[model samples]
Target: MAIRTTLDKDLDRLKDLLIEMVNLSKTAVEKSVQSLAHQNIEMAEQNIEEDQKINDIEEKINNLIIQLIAQQQPVASDLRTIIAGLKISNDIERIGDLAVNIAKSVIHIGAGPLIKPIVDIPRMADMALDMLNNVIKAYIEKDIELAITTAKADDEVDALYGKIIKELLELVPSKPDSFNQISQLSFVARNLERIADHTTNMSEHIIFMVKGKNVDLNA
Candidate 1:
């Protein structure tokens, strides 16, 4: 009985840490994109600084998962949760890194006005952010549908990214003077798409945790 109680406390701590990781990543992605859209160099700098905090959370989650496995020796269902939680946390950490990448792009683009009025790139960021939020909810509620929804949302982000890239490629030919900003926007779009992919990976991990079967959410 004491062993079961101790395992429960450890798992509870794990869940709390996972939630902290989610919030940190989610806000990092949001603020980073906002910095890009508004040309907020100072906010971009802050976003870059905040990413270290998210990395710290990821380290804590990894350590806690290892501790739980060693002490609890969880079996089957419990074991799946611990292992799958590790995968999801890693994906979240990657998302935070992507956010940092976006901030870096803003730093690259400098303080000049965007080459074009922002449109699809912001749309893509919003969709990816939604995926992050929904995936977290699905994991916490053990809701398979919500997880699936998060995976499917990746398609929208991909489509927006494709559209942005195509348009930018065409623009570079005609707007030679603006080529630099257009190229930087392409980089930003690519980062957003990769963020969506990592968020989709999280949903796939959540499904594995609940169903005990691997899912190809990326396909």
Candidate 2:
């Protein structure tokens, strides 16, 4: 009984850390896009600098998971939970990197006046962040249905990314002078698309953790 109690406390700590990790990744993504749209260099720089915090949280979660496995020798559902925690942390860390990539593209845009109005990029970012939020919620709540639904919803972000790319391609011929801005905006959109993909990956991991079934939502 005492051992079970200690394990429960450790598992609870893992849950809290997972929440913190995903939330920071979401912040990185949001701040990255906002900086690009509003030309806030400070925010862009902060986005890059703060990504380390996400990494730290991921590390902390991983260490906890390892300790739990070694000490508790978790079986069945507990094993699944620890495995899913590892995968989720990895995906969230990648999402943080995507945020940094977006910030770098923003810095490349250099606070210059946008060649075109900012639209789809920010929209896509919001959608991706929402997906991330939903997956984390579903994971913590043990809601496999919500996890599956959120993973499937990545299609909207995918569609928006495609539309943005097509529009940017069109802009090149019509506005030859603004090619740099168009190209940079395309990079931002691409980063958001990848972030959405990572969120979907997290959702799949969550579903598997609960149901012990392997399914791909991206397919």
Candidate 3:
């Protein structure tokens, strides 16, 4: 009974850290896109610097999971919970890295005015952020249905990314002077698309935690 109590406390800590990691990643992504849209170099640099915080949280979650497994010797559902948490933390960390990528692209584009007004990239960022938020909520609530729904939203983000690429390609021939901005914007869109992909991976982890079965929500 004492061991079970201690394990429960550790698991709770893990959940708290995971949620913190998610929030930080979300903030990084939001700021990344905002910086790109407004050519805010300071905001972009801030998100890039703060990415370390997300990495720190991921490390803490990993350490806690290792402790739980080694000390508690959890089995069945408890073991599944630990494993899922481990996988989800990895996904969240990658999400943070992708957000940093977008921020870096913003910096590369510099503070110069974009040749075209930003639109679809921010829209894609919004969808990805929403999917990320809902995925974490689904994990907290242990709602597999919500997880599935969140994963499905990735499709819309992908569609938007595709459209952005098409539009950018169309402008390439006519807008020779805008080459650098166009290139960086493409990179930003790709990073946002990848963020949605990582969020979908987290949704899969949540479903595994709840069902003890490998289900592909991304499909």
What candidate 1 gets wrong by more than 4 Å, as runs, is none
Write down the TM-score for model 3: 0.98
User: Once model 3 is optimally superposed onto the true structure by TM-score, how far is the C-alpha of residue 188 displaced, in angstroms?
Assistant: 0.5
lDDT of 2 at 91: 93
lDDT of 2 at 31: 91
Q: Estimate each model's TM-score.
A: 0.96, 0.97, 0.98
Query: Tens-digit lDDT track for model 2 on 1-219?
Result: 998899889888988998998888888898998898899888898889999999999989988998998999988888888899899899999999999998988888897778778977888888888888888989989999999899888999989999999999998988898888888888889989999899898888998899898888989
Per-model lDDT:
0.87, 0.89, 0.90
Sorted by TM-score (best first), the order is: 3, 2, 1
Point out where model 2 deviates above 4 Å.
none
lDDT score, candidate 3: 0.90
Residue 143's lDDT within candidate 1 is: 92
Q: Identify the leading candidate in terms of TM-score.
A: 3
For model 1, the run of ten residues with the poorest summed lDDT: 113-122
